[model samples]
Target: MIAAKRILRKAQRQLACRKRKIAIEEIMESKGDPTTFYKLVRQQRSSTSMGTEFLTLNGKTAESIEEVTQTWAQYFQQLATPTAESTYDDLHLGKIQDDINLINQICNSSHQDDIPTITKDEIHTAIYKLNNSKAADIFGITAEHFKLAGPSLITALHCVYNRFIKNQKIPESIKRGILTPIYKKGAPDNPGNYRGITVTPVILKTFEHIIRQRHQIILEETQSRLQTGFTKGTSPLVSARPTYRVHNRI
Candidate 1:
């Protein structure tokens, strides 16, 4: 259930980013000026957040991911006005509906068999692999980077992801509710901090290679703050300090 939420939230960001990028390109094609670009940035927040899931940043915000998603969907429905006359020709409308149908089958279903299983990590590994293996040059940014999960998966997901973003960035509205795993910051013996990790290309490629050959993606267990700062004095019962990563590959 938790993994499902991550998949949903990440999906929103990924989809919204693509839409935003395309919109920017359309605006640029008209030679829109600096003012237009500034306006674009200002409105970018709404575009990204609207009809999309968001991790609540503060306490006052509602904690329910489902409520937030429903709110977004309602906003989109209200905003997407129907036209009496078809703006899209029959052929175009058909294609659009087809695409929507395909995505719906893949993403929107309660039955496991009905919906194709596409995991966030699997998607990340696919995009990262593609990027390293020539797709990045073609697309500029890898899909994982485009999706903005690389940093979180590597360093912060184990900790920085508050209860909100960790498992429920994307809430599954139709299927069910969201569940957050207990955030583990390590024990008293292994308290620590993670200096931001600079992911090496080799490691990134390793992820791609693993996925390519094994048909599975493995996110290496990252050393987080919990592992580093643990002190024996904090826990008198332990004979040794808790295991922690001082540096690479602990």
Candidate 2:
């Protein structure tokens, strides 16, 4: 009777495992549908409990949910806030004189050529090229919002970009960003295990895209051959060929 009972328990466990496998298979099959995929993921997560309820705070374990929440808040606040002892003068601006001089030379040279004006077509292209899946900024503006706004929004953005360029100023709206903490591989409760990523407005991204296009054109003409990373029509493999040949000869 005991052996029969054990067999029945083993069969029940196998049936449960089979059901879970089928559910996972269904989720994999529905990957094309993002909504369904995310829903399944949420359901899966809800079924499991995170083992970490307490967090280490200042060498002490936070026992309650309130304590954990407070500890996290304090951790983030301290991480974000600058130290009182640190001063701007302590940065030693003179150390970067050579870099500053080189940047000034580049700027002066670039200015000698006529500055490219922002266009509606460029703005439209930048907006349309933006990925819809990207996170929204503080204002909750996404690429999809701009795409739906159509030609009127594109024209307005073009005007704004040109105006900012002429005035030599950036708008406060563009300057502000939403910082989100992404968990990296480490202890779940450790604040150091997370990295903050800033999400800027899509409109600012569009403007940046236009500027980047112009900057790339200038870089292609003036950039050194030794600086190959992030350059178009070139790869690290192509850059390494010269070094590889030199090593072979040696």
Q: State which candidate has the highest TM-score.
A: 2
lDDT of 2 by residue, 104-204 (tens): 88866664225667888889888887876555567878778999998888878878888887766688867888654434445655667655556678878
TM for candidate 2 is 0.62
Superposition error at 100 for model 1 (Å):
0.7
Instruction: Kindly list the per-residue Cα lDDT of model 1 for residues 3-23, writing each as its tens digit.
Output: 999898778767765664565
Supply every candidate's count of residue pairs whose N, Cα or C atoms clash at under 3 angstroms: 10, 0
lDDT value for model 1: 0.40
lDDT of each: 0.40, 0.70
Candidate 1 residue-wise lDDT at 247: 39
Assess the local accuracy of residue 219 in candidate 1 as a C-alpha lDDT between 0 and 100. 18
Model 2 alpha-carbon drift over 4 Å, by segment: 1-114
Compute each candidate's TM-score over C-alphas: 0.21, 0.62
Candidate 1 lDDT trough over 10 residues, lowest sum: 188-197
